[model samples]
Target: MKGISENMYCSDCGKKVKDGADICFNCGKEIPRGINKYITAENLPEEYKPISMWGYFGYQILFAIPIIGWIILIVYAIGGAPNINVRNFARSYFCFYIIAATLLLIVYLS
Candidate 1:
């Protein structure tokens, strides 16, 4: 017969938890006695993954393009993109452009 360690069980709901998880996703509770460690990942979740340095540089270059880059930036900023990080970046960049353009217009008018 096999025996299960108490650490293997969830503290809140007493359910079996996945090994090395920081929290019991199965029962939505913290692991007992902090036995669970943060699991290192070889590949992070796609949407959660950060944009690479080159990717940012590429995006900057893309946004410099006459028409297509602007379209892509606007679409992503308005939630057209599936990835939240990309959307956030797009929104931030769009805001920067808007601010710059507004400042330019103010300066021109003044």
Candidate 2:
């Protein structure tokens, strides 16, 4: 994210092009600047960055830890986590737990 603008991207390599640059540093392609259609970062609403695969894997591992993991999972699911991706994943995990518990309870009762 550093040295990259949220709005500008290299058309050839798909890397974010430097702001006001005439060429794409990533692909050495000539860039067409001053395009009127592109919206700057400031014009766009604040968005949560996408969670990387490693980040999701780490979160899942953290959530797998017993009672402490449960606490963290609950916290994240309840919007304690800043990233929407993390929060949504946590909520989905929480739902999985709920559904699992319900199934277990039904089986036990039967």
Worst 10 residues of 1 by lDDT: 36-45
Over 9-41, each residue of candidate 2 has an lDDT whose tens digit, in order, gives: 677788976665666788899865454234455
Query: What's model 2's TM-score?
Result: 0.58
Assess every candidate by TM-score: 0.61, 0.58
Q: What lDDT score belongs to each candidate, Candidate 1 first?
A: 0.76, 0.79
In candidate 2 the C-alpha lDDT for residue 30 amounts to 83
**RMSD of candidates 1 onward, in order:** 8.1, 10.5
Error of 2 at 61 (Å): 1.3
Q: lDDT tens digits, residues 1-43, model 1?
A: 5344334778688887777675677778866544654344632
